[model samples]
Target: MAMRVLETITNMTQLCQKIVHINIRWSVLNKVPFFRQSFRFLWDRILMCSVGKSIQYRRLHRCASSPSPAAIECKFASGDPTTTCTDYDKDSDLVALKISLLGDCQIGKTSFVIKYVGDEQEHRCLQTTGLNLMDKTLFIKGARIAFSIWDVGGDHRSLDHVPVACKDAEAILFMFDLTSRCTLNSIIGWHRQARKWNQMAIPIIIGTKFDDFVQLPLDMQWTIVSQARMYTKAMKATLFFSSATHNINVNKIFKFITAKLFNLPWTVERNLTIGEPIIDY
Candidate 1:
């Protein structure tokens, strides 16, 4: 009985070895384009049921034991795992500015930021729950300025947190949807609320979705633009018409603000033609 048990144990060890060898061959075969799609489902199931966990454990252990020195140095230098060594510049002046976006819900505040930052646009508009923060570094006039942008949710329930988020903000962008009169009407309230939190921050009124607004009848379009201009004057804020989807007036808005704040010179191109409109977008 002892001899039989020993033989069985030896056979089982040999079988596991053969299975491992076959798995290795299968791994190589799985990389082939012709076999990949056909074998992927079966390979995944086999790995999950047999060797996946063990292989992952071994790999993690190996990595834990021997971390690369270059990676360690990079981690220490940046102090942020998401930031790489190349992203840091020793000679650039790092000025941190906080800007808050305030507006009614679905008015394209988040969309505008994403477009300006060169991020992919979401197909569906997402309602911001409380506050969404994004960071961007801009190099203007040989100076590096880092902007910390906060997008405050426009929902009534989220409005309570707006004051807290707006603290220490250097500027506030109050946006409204040009196609929605209700959103435009709500701009004054949003501006007041933001000013209550940070009075020193410069305020700018942004009229979004201009592409859709322009498609309306001439009279209706003029009405909306006139109302927006009135609000801009009343609030003593600069007004800009923008379309994030079309990448219009997005970068120009930020550039104008930066130039104004830093006392930098910015030249505006004028349209000499009498009947033709100036194309600034």
Candidate 2:
């Protein structure tokens, strides 16, 4: 019985690899009929297999509505696994996604991620010379989903990591310090660099340190937000103002991504009030 189970598992692995190969060759093949049948077969087999770990969702709300993304340009799967996640995710059948965070130095990229993944997981994050990698898993309808986040340091020396970080990423977040216009201005260059590797990754503009931003004069806030909105329109990306300290818009950002990807209904209103954090599409 043990040998039989091993053979079945091995066959399942090979089938999954073939399906992934088809996805990689999608544009070149353009064989809709073949892919349709292939995926149908794959799904039937997957549904019958009852293996993989169960992870609890991290404050993820039950989504009832269909997903509505701001734009649909390109898509890519996760790159080669860079680091092993905590044991919590091993052997799990969760849909793993790659997310990239790019910005100038000390723009709160690490803090933003730490808040979402939690402090314990933060300690397990791999801190290399120029990159940081963290993983988080969420449970949805008994199925598990994982996000392997790549944070490229915002200095010139760390620029080499951009291509690796962006490659195969499903989403790329271009972050900036809300109090510094210069950091915000750096978004154009960062966007250009990232687009070189993956053009289809969902783009998101995030302004960090909202707690400090609100203390500025209302006129200054208006000017900054106006510029941010312009940038968002230019990139055709979603815009969000967040504070890791206060946990403002931090969770909502990931929730938005999940909803958009899964076609789940999301009810988020645009907030343009000067004193409040902004969420504009």
Candidate 3:
């Protein structure tokens, strides 16, 4: 009976050793690229299954108690966020400005705002129902500028609210989709309304979806550019071609506008191709 017990113990020890060997092999396999990718795919699937979509949108507001400009960060909340005191320094003589974005429906206004504010892009595009407001504070040439950006919906029903939003705006960004010629043409009416509301506001003409626009035939590309230049000249507005998705000229647009508005000396270097304008493509 003692001999039988000893044999049983030896078999159990061998089984335990085999189990440890299998675990070590698995650990090594996880480090391999192919096995790692396969594991990641499975893990993502498991996570998706476990956490079904229950996504919620929260508004971000800045806290007033934050004393320093660098320390001010957005605070998440359930309702429409209000402006915070950190947006200005009373002692520094900060300037508060309102900027309005005007454009037709589905013309990438919201996408531009999201990209500017460092937010993730939404996979599906949705129309803005009424108005969406975002605030950003910028330090330019020893002066603090607080901007209250208002994005008004472009539907016909939302047109009534445009005058109110544009009433005291310091600057206006008029956007149009490059893929749609109708949207480009509609800018005239939008510009007219903006001028009627705030004649002093600096106007900027932005051509959105520039990535898709460049894929068109060369002649068509030049035609749109010519039209943009004509309208810009007539309206005395700065012209910019931008693609929020590709991050093309997105930051430059705002920087140029701020510099122009503040009368700050700004210079941009570009390689000229003989016939092309020196603007950043």
RMSD of each: 18.8, 16.7, 20.5
User: At residue 142, what lDDT does model 2 achieve?
Assistant: 44
Per-residue lDDT, model 2, residue 224, is: 99
Ordered from best to worst TM-score, the candidate numbers read 2, 3, 1
What is candidate 2's TM-score against the reference? 0.71
TM-score winner: 2
lDDT of 3 by residue, 126-183 (tens): 3356777776655432345566778888888888878987997878998999878888
Off by over 4 Å in 2: 1-92
What value does the lDDT take at residue 195 in candidate 3? 85
Q: lDDT score of model 3?
A: 0.67
The models' CA-based lDDT, in order, is 0.67, 0.81, 0.67
Per lDDT, the best of the predicted structures is: 2
Tens-digit lDDT track for model 2 on 151-210?
999999999999999998889999999999999999999999999999988999999999
Clashing residue pairs in all predictions, respectively, total 0, 6, 0
Deviation in Å, model 2, residue 200 alpha carbon: 0.7
Residue pairs clashing, model 3: none
Question: On residues 49-99, what C-alpha lDDT tens digit does candidate 1 reach at each position?
Answer: 686334433433343333243433332232232431224356224556678
User: Per-residue lDDT for 112 in model 3?
Assistant: 86
Q: What residue pairs are clashing in model 1?
A: none
